[model samples]
Target: MVKRKSPLRKFLFYFGLVIIASIILIPFYYMLIVSFHADYDPYKTSFNNLTLRNYAEIFGLIQSTEEAFFGDEITKRNLESINTKLERLKSISASKESYLTYVEETLIPEKEKELRNMIELIMDFSGLTPENREEYLQNAMKIGTKEYNEIMENAQIILSEGDITLLNDLYYFLNNYKSEEFLDKELAKVKEQINELEEQKQKIIAEKATEFPFLKYMKNSLMFAGLGALFSLIFAMLGGYAISRLRFRGKGMLQRSVLVVYLFGGTVIMVPLYQMAVKLGILSTPFGAGVYLIIVYIIQTLPVSLYMLGNYFRTIPYSIEEAAIIDGCTRMQTILKIIIPLSAPAIVTVYIYAFMIGWNEYLFASAFLGLKSYKDLFTLPIGLNAFSQSAHSVWGRLMAASLVSAVPIIIIFSLMEKYLTAGFTAGGVKE
Candidate 1:
């Protein structure tokens, strides 16, 4: 018989666990907060300033928008002034002629020569003869149905192919008129042009992010880590089963050798591993680095994975194997059908360990794949290392990158956590 824990003891144990959990989680919490807030200072925290801009910047959104909004600075500033003047006029009762006179004398002349020069430039670019310049200007000024269709068609083509600076000049020429009615009509057309340009920019932005090397690096990391984990799992399973069940000379020595290798930390073997990679001529290439890293990870993590699985295998009753053999199952078939099924939990545990080792092993990845020429081979760790070396560091962006690198590990572990507790059970069979 065993004595149950007292309620006080259980409460104390849970409280202690909570404290330790909080301690472990605080750094992650801080990192998440910093990732969303630019110029974050612990002493001056403000929730209102938290934004997704850092993430947008990382994924190429912010830069794309800026590029799309190019050539519109003067138009924006001049529009503000025009709006203010219009608002002032609204406060007073004035005849249409008075408004027109005010605009003609004050607004048009201020940028009239500038607008005319822009119009002449556009006419030359459009291959319109000088005689047709006056005709196009007349057509543009009419703000009629024919003018609308012609300008919209021509504007679309110009916007699609010409520099944005030309578009800006064209918008200013049409919209900076002295007539109130003309201003309103041209302003509407300008707004429509803005919308079309924005849509074109959106199309460009969609394809632009693929150009970012970090995205490629992330894909490479996922592929390499997955392959490494898969190979490691297989080797660990086979090595573990053989050592645990098969009779062979030097088997004990093999197990001891695994333990000895496992005891050796990564730092101790870094130099030798790099030397070996150079000797093998596997450095700097994606496939080469990937294969080398997978092998290294298997060697480094296999001992622990093997030890865990081997002990678990030893716990299964020998009678189960004997029964399988009596039923005419071969050794390989019995191990596959019986042992592996019973060892699912341990396998999952080992897989998670191996996957994490591959995914997050920064030192090896950086040393092996950290050449500027090996752009495709660069992993998240290497990307982050290079990003951090920029003269101006955006802590928010750095933290976001860190979070991106960590998410796969977090998700995999979270989903598979339940299976881990089922490993190495002694309840295989009983008589």
Candidate 2:
């Protein structure tokens, strides 16, 4: 006998579904709103006005410059000296490689002259010559020694020292000086500057190298997701078949074991898995992280996948396999040709589920990968995390990144929703 759902019960069921749908969509809705909101403050709760400032900042269209003052001047001087040294090293290295070319080619002479002229122009603009360099050093020493002595002699004398008077003196000395001695001093200063530039360049290069991994993170993530999906689907097919068709001792137990894994909770395994990853030296490496993430996702998705496909497989009559065998088709051929085609909807469901699991995974990603600088190996989720941190809690940019991250998943699910729903429902209802 058939029974109709009570009006109140039906109303409650629809109301609950509406609530669940709203809950699922709230994050995405917030993400969209924030992405568009211009003045969304990360620090404040006040949402007074909307502005694109956060988005502009994230995209590097806007930036703040540090104001240079008297104190910063000394730091600037040191940086200039370091930069000069680095330039000299680069020139020396390049010259060493192209010594023969420099000696033989007219083009090389022209280029060298142009480079030398450019360097001289820069030095002139900065008021940095051999005389200036020497004067700067002399003033630096005098200020340090004299200031310390003055402070020690009578703390009140500190005010009497005045506002870096030595800097004015050094500037005057460079402005007035013009002799062979001055030229020699200038040449020596230029050489020192070149050496300093070389060192600064090397430091910059090292810093950039440190950030290289973050660049590759996206590529690695995509590769990992693709491979993980492929491997999981292949394995899930076999696991699903074993659970569905093969009658063996403990078959029911094996089916129930998958449910137990789901009940056990993913968080419980995180610590042990992380320890194993660290022990295996896979923590920092892309291959290790990718493989580990794949394993985690496969295990996490396996029970559901197996159960879903197993139920689908159960609906198929054994006579289909028998008829294939009568046609002289091998077991593998029969499964591939007959069974797989019939289970296309289920396979698609499992594929989508596995892909989504891989795409949205974060815990293993955060635990396995220590730094965000490994950009090359970043998945969309990891990239979004990095983008959020880079934005320094700016909600608009963070939401923008979040919105971008979700677009792919949304598109995928939207396209497969019908098939997925059908597969899920079919797996539940047996004829």
Candidate 3:
């Protein structure tokens, strides 16, 4: 009979796995839930209130409703002010003669005239004309059932065409005053002010609703991390090949000291690194920050890269390299043609490792590039930190952005993971 491990041990092993997996997955599940629901309440939102708008907003697909609301608020307030004054004036007047005189002199000609200019901009677009439109000053009571009906009909047409400015003006003109022939021009003026309000709102949204900090930070991170990973891969491969293949002075000491950077945690060396960067002036400009970050990333990746690749390089048989030399291949040509192609899997692994260090690193990046003036050079980690601390309470957006940032790591892993499993196993592993 084949010997078997105890069932109790297997049970405990699976149990531990389940517990650890839950610990990791619970927060991720919550973040995903929150991303889908902007107004997330733990107790509620079981079936309703789910939306993809959070993703849409982060990716620049749609504008946030809160932004749209604030953009329109200026015009809304002005509309309310005009309405309030008109109501107050109506109540204070002693009689119809006085009310007509005050409105004609103060409200219509003065308050309404400024708005009238704006309406003329899109008069042709308004869909109102002589037959249906009420004339403003001829008789205040000639806005009959037929004219009122015609305005409503045309307002719907304006609305369907997405001319909200014109629709609003029509509604304002209809509700505010009893009308006549002059009412047509008066309605036109209301359109102008509403249009101005709409323009102001559009302008505000245009300024704020863009793919900034996200796209910018992504670019900086990619450039810094990309260059770091590439250089680390190249230098690590060379160093690893030298150590594994060449007999040189202090080789043992060099191999041992290569990993010494890892002994001091980032917190331990952070102050020293910051001081050094300050002296070097690498924190002075965005270009400097980028250079420093790339150097830092290389440091973070190189030690592990050297160790991983060095050990893996040793597993390849020495006779293959001897054959390359017999074929008159130079040392560098041997590495390029024989060793590098054979070590493809390990190189990819080291690259992925280096990339991850640069991508997810926060402590050094923040310490070195965290000056307020250098915000344009912020990496994804720095941008996310600032985003989370923003005064705007956009939890859903934050959650969405956090997940979106992880996509690159996921993609990199997926595209390169196939190379990871067969490095030393098939590459002539030996002591």
- Which is the leading candidate under lDDT? 3
Task: State the C-alpha lDDT per candidate.
Answer: 0.66, 0.60, 0.68
User: Candidates 2 and 3: which is better by lDDT?
Assistant: 3
Kindly indicate the candidate among 2 and 3 with the higher TM-score. 3
Largest TM-score belongs to which candidate?
A: 3
**lDDT of model 1 at position 205:** 48
The TM-score, computed over Cα atoms with residue i paired to residue i, of candidate 3 is 0.63
Task: List candidate 2 segments past 4 Å from native.
Answer: 1-27, 37-219, 371-373, 391-394, 422-431
lDDT (Cα, tens digit) per residue for candidate 1, span 28-95: 99789888865423234454467887677666566634234222343334445555554555432244
Q: Write one digit per residue (lDDT tens) for candidate 2, span 1-431.
A: 99899999999999999999999989778776767763533445655566665455444454322222112243345556666656544454353234233323543345444433433443455445555544433433232454323323332333234423433334333333344464455456656766666666565444323322322444556666666766777877887787777778988887887668766676888889888877888766766676777777777776767777788788889898989899999878987998899998778878777777776677777776535345556676776666555523456656665565567777877888897667657543111
Error of 3 at 389 (Å): 0.4
After TM-score superposition, what is the CA distance of residue 367 in candidate 1 from its true location, in Å?
1.3
For model 3, give the RMSD to the true fold. Answer: 15.5
Find the 10 residues in a row with the least total lDDT in model 1. Answer: 422-431
lDDT per residue for candidate 3 within 1-431, as digits (tens), equals 98787999999989999999999999788788888876433234343488897787677666544324322344345545655654554453545555455556676655455444333323346644464333521222223545445544555554455555654554465446555444545545545655565665555455456424577788888887888999999999999999998999989987876547656667887789889988888788878877887888887778777878998899999999999899999999999999999988788887877777788888888887886357777888988787776544367777888888887787777786666444334432111
Looking at model 1, residue 20 earns an lDDT score of 100
Off by over 4 Å in 1: 1-22, 39-48, 56-214, 415-431
